[model samples]
Target: MAKPARIRLAGTIAATALCAAAATEAAAQTPPDDSIVLNQQLQLGDVFSHQTLNVVDAQEQVTVSTSAQGNSASGAVENGSITVQSDQDMRGDAVAGTDMTFGGDTWGVVNATTQAQGNYLAVSAYDSDLTVDATQSNTGSLVSATSQLGDDDARLLGGAYINASAISNTVAMYGEGSFVGGTIDQSSSATVRAYNRIETQYIPAEAVIDSQAIVNAVQVTSGQTSGQNLAIVQTSTGAFVEAESSANSGNAWDLAGRARATANQAVLYNEGGSVVADSRQDNTAFVRAAATTTAFDFGRAEAHARGAANELSIGNNDIYVEIDNSQFNSGGVDVTATFSGANGYDVYVGADAVGNSVIGYSCSDCGGYLEARNSQTNDGDVSARADTTVAGSTRAVITGANSVGNSATFHVSRPSH
Candidate 1:
């Protein structure tokens, strides 16, 4: 009986110990939903003196990771200041389904990452006498960041950085001092808008920059613009344009290898400049005077129109050209420059028709007019009363098949009653 009692007691003690261990494990496995919420708003008042931590929080649907592994740091967020001496590195990442918002500021070193769909991110950083960096990569998304620096000096770099294939993204930078040394690179097919209004700087090769407006001193670039529109470049003191093109075709404003503009009349100037408009189709070039006191001044304006069966036409304006050289083909109407200001002028020299076809027109006034099928090249007669002297002759040249060409050519001829 004594032996049995001892054995029973031993069994009872072993069972109690097993039950205690199981209870301990059950308590430890409780969900950490509340702890995660508290850490989200955690702040440090000051010096984190020699505190080592490797924390990992992984939940079923979401996760928050915080790590610090290196030296000396001092900074503040919402009146909370933290200073760390001797090696410190921090990394925090969050992932979810709907959206994610992230923020950080480090005097030591920091790295952050996030992944989600249909999200927005706004991050900022300030560093003193230290190096700061940020990187991001995403698709079908949008991101924006703004950073500032103090006198101590800070550097920021970004990579592949922002990708939003089917969305729009904006990145802006503002600085009080200067870019002592830093770089920002952003690339995407989707539209990107960057505003850098620094005093003056240099932008070298394949650097794409777009802003609604820019005020700068010097710029060097090789660029191209298409689509029928207007390109306005404004400078307070002076403006310059040096350009060259291969071809321009189709429409009322097809400025192929040309430079033109409209401006105030009082102080109009075009020094050491050239404007060339080549019209290779029917009624291809026309200039309209937007102002009444039209002061036209062109330095070295040479307009050329050449090719089989092409025509160049000009309209109402005051034009003063230092050197004007116009070229045309046998089946092409070389020059047709005309103005109708009670005092308009005409300066042109070339064929009267294109291959057996004659171009003619009859006009009672500017408002009432009727043109012939072949009159596209016909320079019939010009009648005008103006204060300025006008000198030019209208003639017909038989470059088309002489056997098939017709001509009742007349210059300044009014039919007699």
Candidate 2:
């Protein structure tokens, strides 16, 4: 009718330019020996009106590659928001070959009544010569509220690797929140090789009326076998709180390690409140080895009219090597506390061990205050152990080497005036 409708719109624009030139020559080739490669990006913004609310953003990226032998590569990202002002960023990458495997992941969220912020990053790399296994992971979260006030922030980073001959590496990070006054930070780092195994972690909880929950974590590894490294931070508040965890290792043999920091506070009319927890570990081992490090710091405070005070700490340190038939085993520092109103308290626990055959323990409780400390040192046929328990009003003190299959127990209930 009009010249055959202009030849059917010129054959649908020449088949959409030959399907966008075959998707740009299959994204410029290179990834085909039993192949798989992927790339992804997503962004969403726009939803406002509740007395002028604006600015919501999201971003993501993923890349993957695989070659032969049951090949696999994966990348993922998810982001969310409800805003007066909110921001988010996510990144991921994966590569594999020769009995190949790779995975990268990222998740993010932002809910703002006034302001919110988030950032997440993930990287995975494995180029095999055969026998290559690799994994990388990252997680994130953020929330903010302001009727006339603002601020909220979150960050996470992960890295994984396998560069030849028996490689297994893993890195992890996690975050959580609820804010009315802002300020929160979480961190993670990891490296792996040689009898490969490495882990890094951060756990977060925040309830802000005046805001504060900050955490920093670090993990590293290379060469000389054996594995395990952990860091944990827990927080709850009506006011102030702080937490910390630090770990280091190399040349490890049969090692189990831990670091924990915790805080809890409740204030209705405010009389005073503060809480802190810190854990640290350093390791080197050989000669029939076993190494254990535990550091736990806990705090609790509650106030209705007057008195409210709490502080707790735990520290364990080890440097290893026990020869002459070898066998160096050490577990040091454990501290715990539980407290209730109308004040009256002080508690501390400490344990230390060094070289040639050692074992140790330390415990503490406040609310009927209690303390325990144990230590061991040097040479062959060396042994030291201690245990203490106090329900209320029990006191203990013990010192060093050959406490001869040691034991100490105490229980006291206070309510007799």
Candidate 3:
């Protein structure tokens, strides 16, 4: 086998600069808006027989807006509107390495607004490391829109109004190395008034690995209107080791809103022992309304893991609605785990809604209107142990409706030993 490339951080910088330059040239040939906002691509062949270091640091901020108006002959404006928008796209790749250390950090932010019957919006997308093959260690942090919004409108409008997304991390790592530590964070917010609407949507986070990996932490937050979060991890021949995730959503006053977190893990191993410990936490709060209208606040958490000759443990927690509301709503939590490997054990735990909701409403028509529907569904705990040659066990625990409308669910499956 050929020796791996011993590239230092300086060499990595030089290589990245060259790649950026090439990308810039390619971008220049295309229409201004028809190109990717940011892109990073790394390619390496062969393992690093010697110790090496590779580092990448990047940061960016963007804002975009547009407005229009029409005035009548009498100097009165018939219609006036404004629109704000922002978007980001990123890509990266790395192939080849052993006994090497890699570090990277990328951060981005966006602010958008529209006034006078206008709308405000913000969006972000990340697609990093299409393919990666490193046999040693990897450490990095990728974050977007973490700070609180300064504007008054943004603060009042809440978390659902801002939209942020991470499409996926298409990476593949092999050999006996460990992922070590890494974090992926994304957040955004938007505010609007006067017959306006705000919406935020996020796709699931995805990753694939073939070696021992440890995810130190992962966090996501959404304010105001609506928020959604998801994560998926797959390992073909190694153990996940340890992982943790947290998701939160702020107040939502009108219409339908939700906050959710989900994780999926799959491991395939024929021999040897494997172990996984993954935990997830979710929170949704301050869903209230003064008018006699309908409102929905939902918080959910889910996880699934599968492997052979291994031990798996998972936890899911949710906090749904902490303030009183005149409108009807529902909130809950869901957890699931699956292990296909023989001679292994699985454990799962879940909790939902552990807080207070003070009531204060002064609307004359509230009594006349029918009370809003309120419901919380807790699936309870479930576990199954299937065929196994040696020894195996499955356990599940759940806590639901500590205060208000909160539900928790859990499920586990394993082969008998």
> Estimated TM-score per prediction?
0.15, 0.19, 0.19
Residue 143 CA displacement from its true place in model 1, Å: 17
Clashing pairs in 2: none
Ranking by lDDT: 3, 2, 1
lDDT scores of the candidates, listed in order: 0.18, 0.20, 0.20
Off by over 4 Å in 2: 1-27, 31-122, 127-417
lDDT of each residue in 97-137, candidate 3, tens digit only = 11211123213333322211111112221221111111111
Give the runs in model 3 whose Cα sits over 4 Å from its true position.
Answer: 1-138, 142-147, 153-160, 166-168, 171-258, 261-417
The TM-score, computed over Cα atoms with residue i paired to residue i, of candidate 1 is: 0.15
lDDT of each residue in 1-417, candidate 1, tens digit only: 999999999999999999999999988997432211111111122111111222222111222222111111222122111111111111221112111221221122112211111111121122211111211112211211111111111111110011101111111221111110121111111111111110001111111111111111111111111000011111111121111111111110111111111110001111111111111112111111010011021111112211112211211111211111122112212212121111122221111212112222222232222221222242222111111112322122111111112232212112230
RMSD of each: 30.9, 24.9, 27.7
